[model samples]
Target chain A: MIATRPLYTPLDRIGWLNTTIRCVLALLGSYANAVLLGSVIAITLSMPAKDATMSAIMLGFVVQLLAVIWVFYARTLIGAFVGLALPATAAAVVLHLLGASL
Target chain B: MKFDKPRSLRKSMTWVHTWTGLPLGWLLFAIFVTGTLSFYRLEITQWMQPETQQASIYDQGQGLSTATKLLEQYASDAEFWSIGFPTARNPLYQLRWRAPEDKSGPENAKGKAKSNAKGNANGHAQGNGKDKPQRGSNNGHNATSADTAAKKTNAEQSQPAESHLAKGADGDKIKPQQGHRGMMQLSLDPATGQVITPRETAGGEFLYRFHFQLYGMHWSIGRTIVAIATFFMFTAIITGVIIHRNIFKDFFSFRPRKGQRSWLDAHAATSVIALPFHLILTFSGLLFLAGQLLPMVAGAAYNGDPRGFLRDYRGFGAEQAAPNPNAAKLVDISAIALDALKRSPAGIDSINIKRPGKADAEISVTTPEGSLFSGKQSLASLQYNGVTGDFIPATSKEHSAAETIWKFMLSAHMGLFTTPVIRALLFLSGVLGSVMIASGLVMWLVARQREREKLGYLPRGHRLVEQLNVAAIAGLLSALGAYFWFNRMLPADMVDRSHWEINGFFAVWGLCLLHAIVRPHLKAWREQLSLATALLITIPLLDPLTGGNFIWQNWLQGQFAIIGFDLTAFALGLGLLYATLQVKHKLAKAEVTKAVPPASR
Candidate 1:
């Protein structure tokens, strides 16, 4: 008997839905991570007072790092979400402690 | 359009990729490596020059005062005394003075028209008797001679010796003086006018030169090459992005198994992960030479004034006019400027005196310590009148928003302003960048190994590539390690000591390549790598032996450049050792698996 198989099996309906939910979660996580990291950087750089431009740069760097993490683990959507979000949340909390208004 | 066969298109595209990348792959690899290292060239200099280690912590007040006094005394008649403040990488305060009439003697001269005939057969070798009679006939010449004789006889006059004009090969009167370039550090005693620091040649400047100007080429040629390279690099990055459709997927997909597959995976991963860095670096490197490449545009748009373009990009006023020649006069209160600088809230780093003591002379103050790249392009400056000590009405845009952004970008690129943590991060990224290249090179070899075996002759093409791989990947590192060894081992009193060190570096590198060509290929790789690893690890040990501080002390004292060099060398050594181990493991496994028949193996 001859056997034929694919390396990756096609996703069932439930599997497809699960993957979609995970991917959406991952995207949200990445966004959150970026905001949080940006906030931390903004707070650290905000000498004397908080400013808009420095905040923007911080946001950009955070976004870049988040994108890097997300892209690498995107196939494992949930893993990507967790990997990105943790850094973001941690940064946000740290910034809050450091007296960032936002 | 009709639908095309996807398979044929893919094959053709693959071929295009291979052909495009293969030719410049090694050159590109070297550029990336050296460029990364060059980011911290100043720090590297500090690490290598142990003499600088004794310099104390930066004291702005003392440094400024010292500079003020020094400049007032020595550069009082200078066109400009551009003082460079001490930093983490360079502890010594450096100053440049462009004075009138070539201040130093002929000993510092670069080239000389050899005195072909020591004595003239007719005692007219230097000048004929007729010319001497003409000189005697002139009363003005007699008066000048009498004044010079009186000055020589004076007990108090500590002025430099009078220079006698020499006849050149063409019989043109030549005023032979030191032809050496850059600033000379004057002696401690203000009146002496002697050299104290033995005059350091600009080695770091050469690295800067190499970035734009390659060796064995004129400045124009080098600049054109650099400009073109910069332009193509920018285009390459964009094309690379277009080509890497699955960049994300390849980021973490490193597989160091057998030959071709491993190299491909390594290349993909390195090329993908560092995309942002590569893009920024290539663009910025080009941007540095923008004026050279776009001279026409700059000239047309900015009224043919290069300063106008600089002002637009950097957001600053034109620097104060350079002082006119022969209008210099030493001012009183030399300490005043230094005091004012020290009192500034942000703190002062260096004080540059342009055309010292002249009416048009300007004193420029700056932030002293910064990243190598950032320092080359100053962050902030305030200019003042040299004679009056009045604040010159120059723009302080260096303190402005746009200028600050430029400084930050420069700092980020150089891995300086962000703290030690960022430098370490960048260093790791650089290592990954190197690995990516190494694996790619190896992959090419593996891919063709089978073809060579089938052809009965190990093809010359693959062999050449392999030889280059060994030479570049292992050879460069070994050569650099040897440079340090030579620096320590060569007798301290050796003449032209630094040049010897540089020569030693190239010599070792040349020998490594020679060995690669002569020896059987695998042994060359193993031996060179193993030896390089040993030498690298041994450098830190030699530092302590040479009476330099121990690694622990350097680290604890926050001597980052010093400690960093040792740690970097140690890490590289370990890396090479690891690679050697991998090679051994693979060879052993291949032997065990009997992939080749007993007769062929």
Candidate 2:
């Protein structure tokens, strides 16, 4: 038996689409995380408002990088989507409850 | 590792990288190149304004006194005055005053009219000096010569009155003076109180603005586009790293002249070598524009009052205060400057006096931050009671931890406070990043061409990408050369000369694109690359002809910044010349091989 390469695999196209979704999710998920994290620190921390704001901004970059890396390392597309969406949603709810504007 | 899986994560990452990078590669190149040049922006501006002689050294107290005297003479009734003392980079005292409401119009017009008359008087004086030989000097003609000289002096003295009358007649036709606005900038000689009129040129400022705002677009739109491109760039760099399994190996491996393999190797090597710089520059670029792009966080926190957040983050309140109406005695500004220098030793960067000659006047002297990495937080400033010239300790506040970190990141991104060696390293990294993107674009075309070659036919899209690669990469260099050439060649007195220089830049770039489209890809590459080579090489040669200081003179004077620019241009020109020659040689060899077919063998 001889091994051969497929000329036009449908799975490759599906994978490309999954990667695109992952990228979009990573971006949105990280943005939401930055906002939620920033507000929580601002409201809960005993530090000055400016200090908390700076900390939140710094964490934003870190979370964004992690989220992007997670998108690639997750086992499946659905798994990655769920992994990102859950935290993003939890953070959003907390922020809303805290009366955060965005 | 082992044999490849059919649906691997690495493959997906590769797909993500390719798709994200290819679309914005050209823009990234432009941004990187211009941003790199901005590191030397001050030097470029210094070279452009060659007529302004560099102030060798000046007593700080003397310079401050000169500034104070000039302000007293020209703007005693003004509400606010700012004095920027001479520095190594800029050798003139930059003074600006905000006029009082009552003094802004009629007083300003009268002042301008008087200055115009004075200028005419000066011109007539020069004319009188030139006609001395024609007045005759023999003993018999002495009386006539004396009479002629007296007549000429009388004419010179009357010239100003005549010009003033003519100016008044045409005053209605003249448009309202823009100088009637609140603030007016006046450049003064540091040693003397006399004003110095420097010629106008955009110089390095255009390149600095071009990096972010681009040209011929609203700044907001341009910044948004740049932010978006920066986001994609950040993504692509991440994906690219994730996909590269042999990252360390790729850093050491480069094979030149192997066609597609060479392109791939060069791209990988350049990317890996400057990977850290790419990551930092992209992330920090996005952060620098975060106020515009990610305003929601600040908005949510402070009810859309971004300025409030910035004020707190910077640890300083606004520089201006409401003016006191009561008249007050003014203290010597030089005393305050000297006192501030005694406290900080680095000398003052600038001094701001609010409500000058008023009871509640405030003076602030700012010194450059000692640490190069503090960004906006590096302003070590002292506030003084304007009337007493006594330091006010309460005005200087310590920054919070958050503000310090934010300032550090911002300053790091701008490369402010960088030593020459660090600046050179950053510049080299930027160049490598540019080359990495250019080679990546070329590799895309090469890969497609190879695939098409297997099928014995090339696609139209592949040809288009090839042409675009040549036009964008090589054509941009040629356009930059044209921009520098135009800076030296444009008429100094032409209206809106700066805009014309920029227009010439775009026009030349547009012509290169047209040439790229019309000619074959190989021929276009060779021609544009050769043109860039010639233009870059001749820039230094034309410096002397264009009234700019020569490279050798700059070298002799220990002006490393100007010499660095000329040497960099000469080296880049040499590199392009080498590339052009290689391309020509390759083409000739290909033609010779074609002429002697394999059938002859």
Candidate 3:
């Protein structure tokens, strides 16, 4: 086979397991972070309530996309997890302080 | 850069692209095909309902008078009436009126209302066929709910209004709906003013809804599934770009007949060509389904009842006096239309009355108009008092920057603001997007050839993937072709004819899947695609043979929508034929290679 090995996958059991974890992180963790980011923007953006919510919701997808890429690109699983968690925690705290319900 | 890490950005992205794209590729392909065709949903409907095609050669005065007569005779006691006059795409003289609440039977009302709602579903707001205008100022979340709230206040459906009180910003949402609820309709021949009951086919609406909501199952669940798949597609598109090492160089490169390389090149070409459209459509699709996908985003801010957020997002409350049910003659629609024409000069498209037989009724004469970047089409409309025939000045709200951005993205996604030429380009872009997805899916199978060959024969999973490639790609096309044929061939008055046509689509698609599983791979591709080709090529003939005028005759009548649909189908069929010939040519080469052994090589 004269094909290039640039896109090769050396998926041993541990690597497969690692990929699986990242996949979950990309889907679930990213979404958790995204809604938080969106909520923060929706509440805090100085525009009208409707515009703020809309702009935030639309921008949420971009945040989610980046989070997915970050999950795969992170050096370790812990790094990926913490990257999402820290911001989510911060946003939750802010919303809580602002009397946002849930 | 030389860190001893397993992570390579390009490698991971390439992996992500494949995994995310492959499983959802077939679903995305189906969505693209249907959504692309939905650019001409109204046109497809016009073509499908040929009984009204040759009847578009009448004057606007006649069209309005017929609607007025119909409404006066049959719908005197109705709540509201909407008249969609003869237009280029909407060739039928449409008269829709909501029956007074007590008169409407639940069972009869749901079917009749839903079937007619299918017309407004696509044409009125011009987005995803759902009642919500993507970004219309008269966005129905503000108007219809307010209108429905006035009616349903006695019922329990008025709970969304509690959020309005909490927000206190809805002081401008008094817009009344054109029509909703148990609305009955009449589609008359505009040329002769005769009743033209077009056959009950799902028409383009089934495809439009199925693209997002899918079929058979509960709509919310279907919408969620589509949303998740859409997110996966969005990820794949971005990663696909990241993984393309020489994206620019590869974009222009094509090596035909080189198997794997050719597929890759085709993938690259299609992806690069329609990159902007792919991104816009995928992202906007997520936003379209966002309410289901991320309710928490809106919920978290709006006290876990996002109705407040939705109300504001769709814009706010303006109070208007409700119709008192006191009978009063409606002012002449022709006079209102003439006044509206004098005001706009571009001419009126529809006359939607809030209360047809009441003194306080409002008449809105909407023109076929829009600025492409501003918002959805049909923005230029004049409202009038129903009895005194006074023109009601529009309380035009200034669009916020945020709303403008939202509107721009939405209008671009809907392409409702496009010229005919632009619409064709958007459709072409969608076709390219579909080809991109299919080629990438095929490349996954092709690139795995060495691994399979090294195992001496195909593994079960690889075999399944091979069968799916045939079924999902060519087989889906075959189903769509069969759907069109069923629309022509089915007995029009047969009960549940539309459902039968859709079922015929799935049934043919299921047969193609069975054939794929049973036959050799190449043979399955050849047979299904050839069937699709044959079916599509004869669509032009079907138009004339099955109760439609000749293409030239339609041209004479200025009924260009059907002519356009027929020509487009023929062109698509030609393209498919070319693809079929290529597959057959490949099969021929395989046959020759097998005839001689490795000794010859």
Best-matching candidate per lDDT: 3
TM-score of chain B of 2: 0.79
lDDT of 1 at B67: 51
Better of 1 and 3 by TM-score: 3
Predicted candidate 2 versus true structure: per-residue lDDT over B1-601, tens digit per residue: 1112245768767766776688878787888888888777766665665544433324343456656765765567777677777665555666765556533233222111100111121111111111111111010110111111111111123323223222211231111111212334555556554444433456676776677757777656787788778877887898888778798888788888888889989988988998888888887787666655565555445654544455444333335344567888888877787688899886666777777888988776666544544553345357788898878884444666766756666666667566678878998898898888888887887666546646555567766777777778888899888888887787654566656667788898889889888887677888999999999988778777886768887766555666777888888899899989987886677577753222111
Clashes of each: 3, 0, 8
Interface RMSD of 2: 4.6
Query: Per-residue error at B230 for model 2, in Å?
Result: 1.2
Q: Is candidate 1 or candidate 3 better by DockQ?
A: 3
Q: Identify the candidate with maximal TM-score.
A: 3
Tens digit of lDDT per residue, candidate 3, span B425-508? 999999999899889888987888777666666677777877898888888888988898898898765666667878899999
Question: Clashing residue pairs in candidate 2, if any?
Answer: none
Q: List candidate 1 segments past 4 Å from native.
A: A1-102, B1-17, B59-62, B101-180, B186-208, B226-236, B290-346, B368-378, B392-420, B423-427, B453-456, B555-558, B589-601
TM-score of each: 0.64, 0.79, 0.85
Best by DockQ: 3
lDDT of 1 at B294: 40
lDDT of 3: 0.69
lDDT of 3 at A72: 77
